[model samples]
Target: MTVSSTSPSAQSSATRTQTSAAVSVSSETALPTSETKQAILTQPLFVYNPEYIAFLNKSLATRSPEEILEWALISLPGLVQTTAFGLTGLVILDMINKIRNRRQLAEHPVPLIFIDTLYHFQETLDVAKRASEKYDAPLQVYHPQGHDNVASFESHHGQELWKTDADVYDYVVKVEPGRRAAIENNAQVLITGRRRSQGASRAAIPILEIDSGVTPAVLKLNVLADWDYARVWKYVQENGVPYNVLHDRNYKSIGDWHSTQPTAESEGERDGRWKGEAKTECGLHKDYFKMRANYLAAAKKRKLTESTDFVLVDSEEPSSKKIDS
Candidate 1:
């Protein structure tokens, strides 16, 4: 699919409100009851909420990356800044610290959330430590329940699950745990450093958004949705922001050690990730429907294999029924 990238300047308040109202209209029309809205308000916004996409699109349209960041801080009072310890997100954190410093919001600075897939690089862990200290903000880390470390994970699910079953690996490592963490933390909004120029999947990203079924919150801000690689680098240089050292080695996007790879000068960034595959995200920011469909496809394939094996076993049974006359 040819996806178009939207810059934040393309959004307007009128457009945002109208889009939100349209969502409200569609939602109410579908439900035909005030009680439904109330019920939905309590649940994740994206579950049935239309405004989530509206906001994502609008914010990315109207504001600059920096402006979107400011709005995220202002719009979501109970916002939680989340990241997979990637380069782009770190830039947001750097800017956030600067904003907080200038505004004297140090006492209640925004907190950072990490999924801690337990397969990250030592450098990533070290960067997390350095970042937490630098920002002087609360750091909440979450990991998969059963698998606490890499060795444990490998022992449970043979090594190279990414190659064998990438979707499952993504769901367990990134998607589900992220949802749980946000919910448990009682987050009203989430701030991500996702930018449109990153890849095919994220091209149409909006700046301000609701998480739809993915998150219970009313808003999930992609504060830098429009930022290109050049702008990101420029911002970092201008602010003297500390970043993960991996970027120097052509690792544009950083994730768990097993999943990420460096890009070559000619191949373009994001090449190493999901190499030889059309996949971009690791079941994180894409729509819930897509993620579910992928999971189901993988599950069905596995089931089919099992069914075939069962048939073969039954056929191979020696004289079980005396040739079944």
Candidate 2:
């Protein structure tokens, strides 16, 4: 049985400031690559707790990505796959299709949740839409409240909030909406597309993580945590997965056009994201409470300049007309 994480708002393990709730990672022991057939039948360990780590070390490490995901489907009732339709995400989406078609999965084996920041490149939107239609995924899309368009988003958060304050931008566009999606859907597990080879921030990404960083700390299972970029691309190409078009333009990791850029041939997959900055993971994979606090602080600062506290009344317009409204 799992206990409440350190913070009530725990969403990811990164949120816990306290050390007790944190499910620590150890590179000391490398898990086996493949498991025997007998292990597949065993019920996965602790769908809600950090004990999932023991399951990974003992059973899941030896399984294929497809098998691991299958076990997750059976183990996690509130399982939802969050994707940006990147190569890794698309690859898993393809795997889900294969599993559902071959095996007798329930009507909705796993639902797909997406955060539409409303500032994504046109190609990114097209790719997401295409993947949804192609796979017949039970898709749930969440966007920034009251700012579904660029103009409204800028008006409220200031023009290009990401440029001014990346934390606030991330909270408004990704973290808050992600938490809202989890709450609205009653989702307990978030199947992420993260891989260990993504770089430093993800260097220690485990297959199962108890993320107690949002309300009701979410369980995150990175199916492709062991796979590298080359392997991920291999699976996508071999499976004919529908991926984002921007990847064709040397853009390895694509987010909003303003924040993301094409990577040099020598860089890693995520190097393209939050380019020129030290940022690696988006707010989606980070601690939710800290992100919220940071965003609130940043927004308060912006209010000083952006707040319409003393707008000059248009004296040219009729005073009576303005007053009545």
TM-score of each: 0.71, 0.77
| lDDT for each residue of candidate 1 in 185-299, tens digit (9 for 90 to 100) | 5566778877777768678766655455565455667777777888888877787777789888888778778768998877756777877778877776756556656765765
- Model 1 local distance difference test score: 0.62
lDDT for each residue of candidate 2 in 1-325, tens digit (9 for 90 to 100): 2444333332345533222221232223222222321243243432343443544434666777887776666544467777777888998888888877776443446667778888789998888888877877656776775555788777676687777778878877887777766665446678888888987778887887777675343577788999999998888888778888888899998888887899889988888877778887778877787987786677576553423111222334211110000
The models' CA-based lDDT, in order, is 0.62, 0.67
Model 2 earns a TM-score of 0.77
Error of 2 at 189 (Å): 0.7
- Compute the lDDT of residue 322 as modeled in candidate 2: 9
Model 1 / residue 208 / CA error / Å? 2.0
Top model number, lDDT: 2
The C-alpha RMSD in Å for every predicted model, in order, reads: 13.5, 12.5
Runs of candidate 2 with Cα error greater than 4 angstroms are: 1-52, 104-106, 214-217, 301-325
